[model samples]
Target: MKKTNYHTHTYRCGHANGNEEDMIQAAIDMGIEELGMCCHVPFPHYRKHLIRSLPSVRGVRSLLSLLKAIIKDGPNMRMPYRDMETHLELLSQYQKSYEDKIKIYKGFEAEGLSVYFDYYQKLLYEHKVDYLILGHHFHKHCISNDYFGKEKMTKKDIYLYCNDVEKALETNLFSYLAHPDLFLIGYNQFDLDVQTVSRRICQKAKDLNIPLEINAGGMRRGLKNINGEQLFLYPNAHFWDIASEVGNDVIIGFDAHDPSDFNDAMYNQMIKFAQDHRLHLIDHFDFLQGDFKKFQSEYDIR
Candidate 1:
């Protein structure tokens, strides 16, 4: 298989390290043929949404973080909207500069928040991004209380996450589902509810013709012993068992938060995981376009 990774992040996201060039050079050194820079998407008027979500803030830390984001408009979790133009412009320059070494594409790892659907559509339609991947990390808002990857997500939260993913996929905006089993990070145990939702997510992606990512980030976290079985937090054995059964297409994502994450060890691990699961792994995917007419009608845009 040709080495390619579509899920990569940059230092602009605050939580990650490495700049655009640092990441690109790493990919080229690792013999990656194509690389997509899909950092956590920045939002315009992010503080407005954070302020509106004040009532939903649950704990002191989360509340404080939200307040800080509202006040600073800095990279709380993502780059600020003010940095969006510069980020994309630099990426465009790198794409051209690195054309001979590796194919580069601009993209974002985005949340499936309804409030930002319009913004996502704008990003795609305006050619600002080549694609968006559904990395639904939060529900309703970007606060910690709504974070799906929190240490204690409820059954209701998982259901809401699944619903948001389905809604986003239906919009045809997201090219693939990133870490589709992210709920498993907090909600341990491969019980009936987990099975039900996993099947639903896999089936949805299968039907939509969007590939599900076997994210290496989860693998990098190391294995956890859950219910007598040691498994990666995501690309969870149980989840992929369902995905394999449902016959969904799979893609290996470095989900690189650092330049070193583009190494052969992680890549090989992902490949073997896909092979072990009997997943139909693909090296590339179609850059699905956003259906602006449908988006306009659904959002009641003129």
Candidate 2:
């Protein structure tokens, strides 16, 4: 049972639990062949102004410094880019130390900043990121500070999210699409609009030859009931049903926020989901096996 998940998160993202080593051990315990430490990429520019100013000017400045300290500690609250250097270092060290046991990869789950492509480019050039997965968790961009918060997405918003995803894919930077059906999180219903967007995404993925993840994080979080039907926000039956027809490469994501959740159950569920949908789920990705330097040169990566 060789399996790999390139959509894992770290404590630096302010949401996920566990240290990098903890995650590695958890992966080993579950017999995972490869584990990718794909923490959220930092948007330094977006973070600088996200934290509100305090009542007093000096106090506000103090707050900024304090937030910076927290970022330094790897919490990544109001600042994100601060900890990436350390994240890379940790991954590199752990990968070398544990090479005998299991395969480990260093990368980021990037929500590309379309408005600030230069900043995104800067990060790529600055760091030797192994791979980038397009995880579109926001509406327009992460800078909008807008979570996809509506109870039900309007047709316009659905298109916006899909467009953002397309833009990220066109950059030719991402190795695969993470949680491709994430747009359905807020949008509980399945209709023509959702189907259309899903097809558009799958079409691009087919064209690009990039794999789309059948994310397991949603199942670990718990199922949601919409219109009396139980389903995960992503790995939506409707979306995958369309994906099967579109014929895009698919992979499973552990999305391991807490290392303990990376278990046999998680692996089995992904296989079961893919089987139920008739998706040609990939057991391993060749992209993860090549030389990083060669990949960078080939894609002009950065």
Candidate RMSDs in order? 1.4, 5.6
Q: Alpha carbon lDDT of residue 15, candidate 2?
A: 74
lDDT of 1 by residue, 1-302 (tens): 89999998998988888999999999999999999999999988788878888999899999999888889987778988888899899999998998999999999999888778878888898899999999998887788878888888788888888888898898888999999999988898777888888999999999999999999988998998877788888879989989999999999999998999989999999999999999999999999877888677645652
The C-alpha stretches of model 1 lying farther than 4 A from their native spots are 297-302
Residue pairs in collision within model 1: none
lDDT of each: 0.90, 0.73
- How many pairs of residues collide in each model? 0, 0
Worst 10 residues of 1 by lDDT: 293-302
- Whole-model lDDT, model 2: 0.73
lDDT of 1: 0.90
TM-score, one value per model: 0.97, 0.82
Which number leads on TM-score?
A: 1
